[model samples]
Target: MMQFCYDDLDQWCHHCVHFVFVDEGLIAFSSFVLHLCAIKA
Candidate 1:
C-alpha cells in the first residue's frame, strides 16, 4: 500500500477525489452508486 507520511492525507484525498470522479455528476452520491472515496476508508 502507498504510505502517506506527515499527515498528507488531506492533499492526497483532494487530489484523489478529483482524479477518480473528475467532479462529474452522481459521483457525489452514495458509494453504492459512485464508490468514490468511500471504499471502506
Candidate 2:
C-alpha cells in the first residue's frame, strides 16, 4: 500500500508538472505525502 502510494505520487508529480502551470501546490502536496507516509511508517 505504501509503495503504491509513492508510485502514484511520482507519476502524479510528473503529470502535474507537465500539465499544470501551478507546480508549487503540487510540490507541496508531494512533500505532504512524503511526511504523511513517513509518519504512517
Query: Taking the tens digit of each residue's C-alpha lDDT, what string does model 2 give over 4-40?
Result: 4346655444443333234665766667665655565
Segments of candidate 2 deviating more than 4 angstroms = 1-25
- Candidate 1 minimal-lDDT segment of 10 residues: 28-37
Looking at candidate 2, the ten consecutive residues that score lowest on lDDT are 12-21
Q: Please, what is the whole-model Cα lDDT of each candidate in the order they appear?
A: 0.42, 0.50
> CA lDDT of 21 in candidate 2?
30
| TM-score of each candidate structure, all chains considered together | 0.21, 0.39
Residue-by-residue lDDT tens digits, candidate 1, 1-41: 22441246454444434443554663654233334235536
- In candidate 2, clashing pairs total 0
**Residue pairs in steric clash, candidate 2?**
none
> In model 1, what is the error at residue 7, expressed in angstroms?
8.1
